[model samples]
Target: MKRRRKKRSTKQYAVIAFYEKNNRWPAPSSQNVKERHLGEWITRCRFIRNHSPEKLTEKQIQLIDRIDADKAQKKTERWMVNYEMLKDFVEKEKRWPSVNASEPEEIRLVNWCLSQRITRKNTPKSKLNKEHIKLLDDIGFHWSSNNKRRTWKESFNLVKDYYARTGQWPAHTRDPEESRLAKWCSKMRAYKNRTDTSVTLSPGQIKKLSNLGFDWTNSQENNRRSPENTNRIWIERYHHFCEFTTNNKRYPKAKSGDPQEESLYSWWMRMAYLKRKGKLSNERIHLLDCIGFRWGKGNE
Candidate 1:
């Protein structure tokens, strides 16, 4: 009598043949019925091996485990090879690889670094290997550019003295310190207006700035003073306000966590400020009145 073959050995053979021919594993969604069946069989075997190992025979168990082990080993080898290539590239270039590198190899390394950063950010610490994290950290790899910049407190202290003396935030000018402080103050205001930012001013920091009488809307006010300002621009903004009111049937709110709405609210506040100073034109006031725009206590 002929020797009996192991059950499901034919399916394993089919899967291996398919992978070798296509240079990819058979997918369950394949149009070919035979290939789809083989793909599903492999998937079931993998699931059984992971969740209920006892369900698989010794031959099936060995087949899946060996395939998985080989794939994992290859993946790990490739990762280490890329890591070494990145380290060498960085050493020679005296900088981290840029995605815009002229060479394909340098660009690939930059993408690999980006992938590593993204994986570390999205993956929980418990699920990630410390060894991999340590290897990258050893090279002084920066997860974010923010990590290398001056701290929030440092920027705050630098600007605090100037604000007290001048009664206004420093204007961005040719001077590096003035430009840096102005940019830093604008960034802080953005942090205050945004909810999705990873960095933000703490309650204590806000209180400290508040005590110093920091003008959060100073930048917005400065924009109006720019040479680009024109009556047409103001009329365009008025139309945008009318459109917003028509769409939402409500005024733009403060701290709404939307950049556009926050901008409209700031414009409304600017109008209120101009009105208080008797700088608002009678024509503009009449236009606002036509929209049933509320002023001061009536706005609430």
Candidate 2:
């Protein structure tokens, strides 16, 4: 479809900004902005978005770039909650430690801390402490030259994508991406398959994939329910939580001795998974927005 150029104005810029934020053109009747200006602007944006995205203005490009950078910053921040606790643990340790689900909270704390470089004092740690130095002696504990440690979302996205595109789990030897990460992939497969003793990804990532119908164990590989069935269960539970909130006028609590607390945490974890992928449905978005739930906090 050909796009007819629309007259531009100051308020029409809101349409562009909204488009950048939502990854979609808002209706001309959007009450959040100048409704009158939205019509033409939305039309033009949808046209460019679908057929000529390269024509986006410098400011529009900058806004979109900023959105991505902010998401990356939030991802880093989400990993920060355990940094201090992990650093404290390292103060008394001998060698850089290994982290598995079976490992104590201290080990998982290390895992989370390894993903953060900035300290709570707002300064980046320039030098490693004795335990950190000792810990880095283990190859798995060392950060890459690019300083990339896998965030839970990043780990899930890669493997989830690999399986989606190839219709099979990545091999232990060489995945389609590269042979360099093959060893890590092997460890991930073993952990997911329950054949390995250590955990490679966080528990939340494991559960999200399982909820998406992944079954890594060879003999139990087909254990997953149909995708539709899995999605229905998750969506229904999320709505039930929202219903509880609607009746109580607040969010559900994840607290000790509450059986529903564990379920609430799992729902939020799945929400984070969808958030990272930018795949959350609009209905859930509205409900979450109504409750003002913070996605960055995850379950904790």
Q: How does each model score on TM-score?
A: 0.40, 0.29
Name the regions of candidate 2 deviating beyond 4 angstroms: 1-54, 79-85, 92-95, 99-300
Model 1 error, position 83 (Å): 0.5
Please tell me which predicted candidate would have the highest TM-score against the true structure: 1
Worst 10 residues of 1 by lDDT: 223-232
lDDT of each: 0.67, 0.49
Candidate 2, residue 207: how far the Cα is off, in Å: 18
Indicate the TM-score of model 1.
0.40
Badly placed stretches (over 4 Å) of model 1 are 1-7, 15-40, 145-300
lDDT of 1 by residue, 79-102 (tens): 899989988988898998753354
Per-residue lDDT of model 2, residues 154-216, tens digit only: 445555554553444544331123232344445655887678876656787677877656655
